[model samples]
Target: MEQGLLVVLNGLVYGLLLFMLSSGLTLIVGMMGVLNLAHASFYMLGAYLAYSISTVVGFWPALVLAPLAVGVIGALVERYGLRPVHRHGHVAELLFTFGLAFVIGEIVPLIWGRLPVPYRVPAVLDVPLFALAGTAYPAYRLFMMLISLAMFCALFAALAKTRLGLVVRAALTHPDMVAMLGHDVPRVFTLVFGAGCALAGLAGVIAGNAFTTEPGMARSLGAIVFAVVVMGGLGSLSGALVASLLIGLVQTVSIGLDLPFYKALSALGITVDVGGRLHDLWLLSVNRAAPVVPYLLLVLVLATRPRGLLGSRSA
Candidate 1:
């Protein structure tokens, strides 16, 4: 029971982390129709920025400064890099962002070197929060959960209940109408893009210490972020949340299980003959296959429901 609970909690932690990263992309794609392939680069930048800032000022300050810096960079990228290509349509925009992602990927290794940095959890949050089912849960994980939940609430309230949210949403479907109403529609786009990048940055800041902070971190997470966005629906925040939690739980549960492929199949009344070449494949344990679970889920979702769980429009 305790182990099961631990797995669930771990899954939630991971799911929320994914949400933090993907929510920004959802907003940008949904609102501006710009894919921003370099989105995960912003996440990597945040982690590196936080690492640098924390080394000088401390983690608390880095937590605020790093994301803000990333937001500013994102805004600049939109204003200068993406705006010119916008006139050429989405293919141009996609190509530009893809190249931009590549550039950022190369630059990071140059700046930070091709190695993982020592971005450890702050000492204050390194202790256990409480015992669950006789297992100790780290306080930092709880902190991460709280931050993610708070971000969701604040983001939801801002979009649904505030004037800016109204304007942003209006700009999405009716940019001309919004512009005619005395709003700078282009400026709105810039802000939205920046805000989205900032969210990705914030995810890096929090997750860097929790996980690993290295050059390849963005590449590792980039695919999963897109998967979550697609599975949750392209621009649906609520869908993203649901999809994030679902993927998180699935991956965690898979890792926690120790059953081998052949045995698992046998328990389901399916039998497969194990041969010399495929014996190792049949003997693969669930824990060893956990990393593949999200992609499999993505494939299933795309095959069955291409529009995603809560997405209104088909991709």
Candidate 2:
């Protein structure tokens, strides 16, 4: 029972982290219709920036400075890099962001080298928060959960209850109308994009030390972020939350289980005879297959609901 609870807690932590990373992309894509392929690069940039800033000032300050810096960079990219391409349609926008991601990928290695940095958790949060089933849960993980939950609440309130959110949502579906109402629609787009990137940066600042800060970190997470977005629905924040938690729990549960395919099947009162290559495949344990589970879920979700769980529009 304790082990199961631990797995669930870990899953929630992982899921919330995924939401933090993907929520920005969802906002940008949903609001502006521009798929920022370089979104994950911004996340990677945040981690690196936090690492550098923390080395000088400390983690608390880096937590604020890194996301702000990333937001500025994102705003600049939208103004100079993305605005010109906007006139050319989505294909052009996609190509530009893809190339931008490539450039950032190359530049990171040059700046940080091909090594994992020592972005360890701060000493203040490095201790155990509590014990469960004789196992200690790290306080940092709880801190991450708190931050993620707080972000969700703030973001939800902003979009669902605030004036700026009304303007942004209005601009999304009626840009000409919003522009005629004395709003700078283009400026709104820039702010939305920057805000989205800032969210990604904040996730990086928190997750870097929790996980690892490295050049390939973005590449590793990039695919899963897309999967979460697609599965949750393209523009739905609520959908993202549900999908993130679902994927997190699924992956965690898979990792926690040690049963092989045949044994798992037997538990359901089914049996299969296999041999050679097929036998080897059947012998694979659930834990060993954990990495593939999210993609499988993605495929399943896409096959069943093309619009996603709570998405109003089709992807």
> Which candidate gets the maximum lDDT versus the true structure?
1
Instruction: Write down the TM-score of every candidate.
Output: 0.92, 0.94
Model 2 over residues 1-315: C-alpha lDDT tens digits?
998999999999999999998899998989888778898999999999999999999999999999999999999999999999999999999999999999999998899888999987999999999999999999999999999999999999998899999998898778999999999999999999999999999999999999999999999999999999989999788899999999999999989889998887788799888565689978999899999988999889889999988898888
Alpha carbon lDDT of each predicted model: 0.93, 0.93
In model 2, how large is the Cα lDDT of residue 233? 91
* Residue pairs with backbone atoms closer than 3 Å in model 1 (clashes): none
Per-residue lDDT of candidate 1, residues 38-149 (tens digit): 9999999999999999999999999999999999999999999999999999999999999999999999999989999999899999999899888889999999999999
Model 1: how far is 176 from its true place, Å? 2.7
Q: Pick the candidate with the highest TM-score.
A: 2
Candidate 1 has its poorest 10 consecutive residues by lDDT at: 272-281
